[model samples]
Target: MLYFIWQKRGDKPLNKSQKAEDQSISYQDWQQFFQEIESKLLRWRRDLHQYPEVGWTEYRTTYWLGQELVQLGYKLSVGKEALVSKARMGVPEPEVLKQAENRALAEGVPLEWIKRMEGGHTGLVACWETGRPGPHFAFRFDIDALPIDEGKEDGHFPYQEGFRSRYRGQMHACAHDGHAAIGLGLASWIACFNKVLNGSYTLLFQPAEEGSRGAKAMVEKGWLDDVDYFVAGHIGLQPLNIGDVVATTSGFLATSKLNVFFHGKAAHAGVEPEQGKNALLAAATAALHLQAIPRHSQGATRLNVGKLVAGKGRNIIPDQAFMEIETRGETTELNRYMVREAKRIIQAAAHMYDVQLEIVEVGEGLGGESDKEWVDIVQKACRNAIYVQHVLPHLQAGGSEDATYMMRRVQERGGKATYMVFGTPLPAGHHHPCFDFDERVLMVAVETLGRCILQLT
Candidate 1:
């Protein structure tokens, strides 16, 4: 029936004329419907990019998201409670516990910790029920910006035109602005065709994906309890020529972020040089040692010291130094090994330099493997929606994502998960100061996601 419907629509961008007798109205109707939503999707993308928000601190973003969902008639539950029950664990801090007790007295949240949580790192889930029973699907959209400055050039829009971010030193260099917009666009499009949906579908507008923190709270709260299939998309620079889509099959490196700090006594360099214990020397030695960590022959592994801060002035010996570093590998075991080796290097360096060393783990993400079933569905949907010479099977990605957490959890429950990489024409690479994407890919992403939801649900 689906094949016949697809043929009748005459909307196959990849394949032309099938027998006219085989054309189906249902497929044609959806094609036309999707085309109609393109303009709205574009607007949403631009609006989101114009006012990007950072992770967990998405107050205005969440408020706007909730308003949009409510306007679409979704019964809104604000904060974590609207999605799931609290985890069995209590507050991690004594100060938080006291605050929770006091906040519980107020009307907004039941506890102070919950209230604090409500203020920052807010998340929202919007559900649309079709009154028909089948598989339940969940789609996640990450809405966070990076802590980089925006690029201001003639080709760029507002930034070039002098409409930069009001909050300086913060910009959406990662293209999450595009991700959030696509999510809202998908929700609006799906809401219009709610009656035709096969089953229950939830739009999970997630926050703080940059730090891998937001999804844990939402999952523990039971937001993912009923979801049978999950999907998420990330916009990236087009490795290929313009107008091409890039999809990865496998190879995301599980990553761990650590902050290494070295402490020593400070002294005047010219007057009392012997009295100073230079922490900067220790930090620099460790940074070089980190690069020397051997790569595993079994899979890919890497270590990078991305940021470093040390010292006050040239005349004063540094009392403290800090390095922001990351380690990654193709598998969890390798990542663990890299982290262990990293710690040993830092400790050894500090010991040699007579400085106190501390290593703090900030974030960790597991590598993800693509589900064949979900990949097939995405490929089919994309092929049907646009012209393509070939559908790539699996593309390997080396970056880390919190979605890997969701993928692991779902796979443990025997559910399928897939992450898609949608191509955009960008002149610069991701995380670069000058990064930007061709907005046209926004439309392609919407159509791809919309069709996949229709076919899967």
Candidate 2:
């Protein structure tokens, strides 16, 4: 049994050999740990899948995780307490946030837990330290869902198993549910065997990674301020096999996520349509032109206006409109150009429509370029796992992740960082309505991460 009380924080005197002996663990021990925690890990993943919440609105998710950490005697830094305010970009309106909270309440989320994550904050860090001094190590896990309806057909595993998302129109279409499960499982593992570690470790449950939002705030707060190594991985991206893991991967596009609002005077459309500036028309116009922006020849570029809403009635001239827009490029320089052009087009549309315009830069994700040296550490870690049949040295990461922001900060300060792709068999592609991953992959990932923490730190 693991003890509730640990020796203390900070360094304690110990001979080199004693420290080495303390850190040692055999392959048999790894299998034993996996068997002990595997079932509970799968249960956690199912529960999370049933109650998916979108970015910045992951109130229940954070509370669920925070309570578990406390039970394990882990010191938790939560919500506004740990976040840096100025670094928070691309946030939704106060009303939109309030509505999401109300829905969570209606769905029977615990009142006390909801109260803890009241603001638009949902990320947290759980830290643990052994008495022996060593380098600081960190692992990040994203804990947000997507805005898609869950497929309730018989073929969908969630529906068949009765774990479909309770909140209608929102689903864990990505692997975040699996990711969080692995994160919490690993936390439990470390707490149970806390004495084996020489260095301190922190697990970062990040929020709003879907739109490349929410990570900058954590970085700005100096979350990665301490010494040494960092690791974060995603499931079912480039690695499609059940046991194949990608040790080193790059190609995360730089992106700008923007939310724009157009305000104008309302008037009856039939009686005095000219008296009102058409905010709806302006938003729609901006959407069409935004997509038509010229693609740069330097590399790959993408532009999208995912959502646009306006107009209250058929006869009334719409007074307000809101739209979400984003642009991406292979490099930071190219992404900047796209952002500049997008702003110019938005301004021109507002001018032509004679409406007041507001554009909020809610989230950003920069292109990723990982350190080659870090790959060796991850490769060595995966080799220790019996289930990891093949370790692909490199591949393209294929999508945008706010983790790249965290990686950039760590690398800038001379600390090493690498984001990995953990393999899992998928029922459908990510962000799709029917997406699912094999529950067994959860154990494989946690065990590999455990080994990495050992060799790296």
RMSD of each: 7.2, 7.6
For candidate 2, what's the RMSD? 7.6
Query: Which candidate comes out best when scored by TM-score?
Result: 2
lDDT of 1 at 113: 32
Weakest 10 consecutive residues of candidate 1 by summed lDDT: 16-25
Model 2 lDDT tens row, 156-260: 778887899988889999989999999999898888777777888878898888888888888887878774787878888843766677777788889999999
Q: For candidate 2, what is the TM-score?
A: 0.90
Instruction: Give lDDT: candidate 2, residue 374.
Output: 62
lDDT of residue 353 for candidate 2: 95
Candidate 2 weakest lDDT stretch, 10 residues = 1-10
Q: Taking the tens digit of each residue's C-alpha lDDT, what string does model 1 give over 282-303?
A: 9999999888898999888988
